[model samples]
Target: MAARFRMKRKGVGEMLRMPGMEAEMLRRAEVIKGVAIGLSPVDENGPHPGHYKASWETSSTRRGGRKRDRAVGYVRNTAYYARWVEYGTEKVHAHHVLLRAAQIGGRNQ
Candidate 1:
C-alpha cells in the first residue's frame, strides 16, 4: 500500500497560484518476519506425550448452538497466531527450517 498526492486546478485564479513543494520523509520501519505452520493429517508425532492426538482433535464441546462451535474454532485459530514469530528470532528461524524440511519430505513420499 502506498499513497500519492496531486494538485488539481480549480479555476483560472488557481492556475496563477504557485505550486507547493511536496516532500516525502521515508523511514526504516520495523521489519516483521513470520512463518505459517499448517498441520496436515500426516505430520509426525513427537516424543511429547498426547501432543499429536490432542492437536488433531476438536476441543470444543458439542453442547449449545452451532455458532458456539464456530466461535470456538475461530478462537483456536487466533491462538495459533501466538505461535507466529517476528523477524530476527532464532526459534522462529529454526521452526521455519524444520517446517520446510517436513514439507519437502512429505512431497517426496
Candidate 2:
C-alpha cells in the first residue's frame, strides 16, 4: 500500500478575503490604534490638550472586485496637526508616534 497526498489550490488572493483574515486585520488595527494613542504627544499647556491622542482611530477595508480580494487595516489620526506631529516641522521635533506604534504592533502580532 502507498500513502496518498492531496493539496487544494486556493491561491493568496482568495486566502486574503477569508472571514478569518478580515477579522485578524481588524484586531491588529485596533491594537495598532491603541499603541498610537499611547504614543501620541499630549500638549497639556496647549488649548487642545490630548486632542491628538483622542484622534486615534482604526478602520479596515477590503479591496478588489465585487468579491473583494484584499484585507487592509488602518490606524489614523483625524487631527489636522497629525502630520505635523508625526513628521514635525523645523521648529518642532518629529515624534513618529504612528510609526513606532505600527512597529510595535507588527512585532506583537
Candidate 3:
C-alpha cells in the first residue's frame, strides 16, 4: 500500500485582497504616523509653532500582484524644514524622529 499526497497553493493575490489587509496596513501606517508626530520636535516659539508635528501624515498601498504582493506604509512630514529638523544642520544634531518611530511602529506589528 502507498499514500499519495499533493500540495495545493491558492496564491497570494487573493489573500492580499482579503478583507482586512488594507485596513490593517492603514492602521499600522497610522501608528507610525502618530509615533513620528510625538517624536517630532516642536518649535514652540518659532514662527511655525507646531507645524512640523502637524505635518505628519500616513498612507498605505498594495501592489506587485501575486508573486510580489505586499503592502507599503508611509509616514511623512510635509514641513519645509522637515529634513533640517530630522537630519539637523550646522548647529543642530539629528533628531531621527521618523527613524525611531518606524522602528517602534514596525515592532508593533
Candidate 4:
C-alpha cells in the first residue's frame, strides 16, 4: 500500500485577506512602489548613454540678418539592480513572495 498526502492551494487574494497577511502585503507593496518610483533614471554620469553624441542647432534670418546656433552632448548609462535569492528552513509568507516578484520585475525593466 502507498501513502499519500493531500495538498491545499490558496489564491493570492485569499492569502492576503488573512489577519497578519494584509499588513505584510501592504508593507511589501510600499517597498516595491518605492523601489520602482525612486529609481526612475539610474546613471553615474548623465542622461545619455556612452559611445554616442547628441546636438541641437537653430538658425534665423530676418531683414537685419539674424543667426543663432546651439549644441548639446551627453552619454547614457543603463541601470541595473543586484540579484537576490532566499534560502533557509524558515517559513515563507505570501507577501514576501509578492515583494520579491515586484523587486525582480522592477530590476529587470
Candidate 5:
C-alpha cells in the first residue's frame, strides 16, 4: 500500500539524544547531595545534629524495575531528628539546608 496509515506527526523518532544524559543526571544527583551535606550545619558532636547532616547519605541504584537501563544516584537522610532540623522543632531554629541545597546546587547540574 502506498499509504499504510495516516501521519499527522513530525519526526519525533529522530530526535537528538545525549549519550551522556544518564551519566550527567547521576553526576548532578551527586552534586546536589554534596551541596546539601556541605550546607548542613555542623556541630561539635557531628554534622547537623538536627539529622540534616547526620543521616544524609548517597547511593547508586537503578531508577525503576527494568523500565530503564541507566543507573542513578540517590541521596537521603534517615535521621529521626532530620525533619525537626529542617522544619525546626518547638525550640530549635529552622535550618533549611536540604531545600536550599536543592535549589542552589541543582542549578549547577
Candidate 6:
C-alpha cells in the first residue's frame, strides 16, 4: 500500500526565518518563566520553599511551522517529595502549586 500524500520535514532555521521571530519567541518564554518562578505558593502547610524556589526553568528554539509554538517555559521542584506535594501520597494532600503556576503563567503571556 502507498500513502496518498507526502510531506517534507522542516528544519529549525526554515521555521524561524522570519524577521526577529526567534528573539520574540525567547522573550515570550522569559516572560512565562518569570511568572512561573514567582508563582509557587508560600504556605506553612506545604513543603519547604527552598526546592520550589530553585526549580523554575525555560527554553526557546525554532521548531515547527509557527512562531507561537517555539517557546517552552516550565517550573519544577527539586525536593525529594515534590511529587508528594503536587500529587499527594496516601497520607498527604495535593497542594497543586505547579498547576496554579501554569495557569497564572498562561494568563500573563
Top TM-score: which candidate number? 2
Q: Which is the better candidate, 3 or 5, if ranked by lDDT?
A: 3
Model 6 quality (TM-score): 0.51
Task: Give the alpha carbon lDDT tens digit for every residue of 1-109 in model 5.
Answer: 5958664433322221234444565677778888988888767686545555656776654442254444556667787777876898789899987788889887886
**TM-score of every candidate relative to the true structure:** 0.18, 0.84, 0.76, 0.27, 0.58, 0.51
User: Model 4: clashing residue pairs?
Assistant: 48-75, 48-76, 49-75, 49-76
Per-residue lDDT of model 4, residues 1-109, tens digit only = 8999765554533443454554444454445544433333323485543211111112222111122121111112122311111121345312232244466644644
Best by lDDT: 2
Tens digits of per-residue lDDT for model 2, 1-109: 9999665556777787777777889899999888888788898899999899999888777663456668877788999999999999999999999999999988988
State how far residue 73 of model 5 sits from its true place (Å): 4.9
Cα displacement (angstroms), candidate 1, residue 84, comes to 6.2
TM-score ranking, best first: 2, 3, 5, 6, 4, 1
How many angstroms is residue 40 displaced in model 3 relative to the true structure, after the best TM-score fit?
1.4
Clashing pairs in 1: none
Model 2: how far residue 23 lies from native, Å = 1.0
Let me know the TM-score candidate 2 reaches against the reference structure.
Answer: 0.84
> lDDT tens digits, residues 1-109, model 6?
9868655556554555544666676666666557656755555675564566566665554453345544333334665666776787899678776677667766877
What Cα-based lDDT does every candidate model obtain?
A: 0.27, 0.86, 0.81, 0.33, 0.66, 0.60
- Work out candidate 3's RMSD over C-alphas: 4.0
**Tens-digit lDDT track of model 1 for 1-109:** 6898676645533333323200100000000011122332222553443332233222322222343221111112222322442122555332332244335533543
- Ranking of all candidate structures by their lDDT, best first: 2, 3, 5, 6, 4, 1
Off by over 4 Å in 4: 1-16, 42-101, 105-109
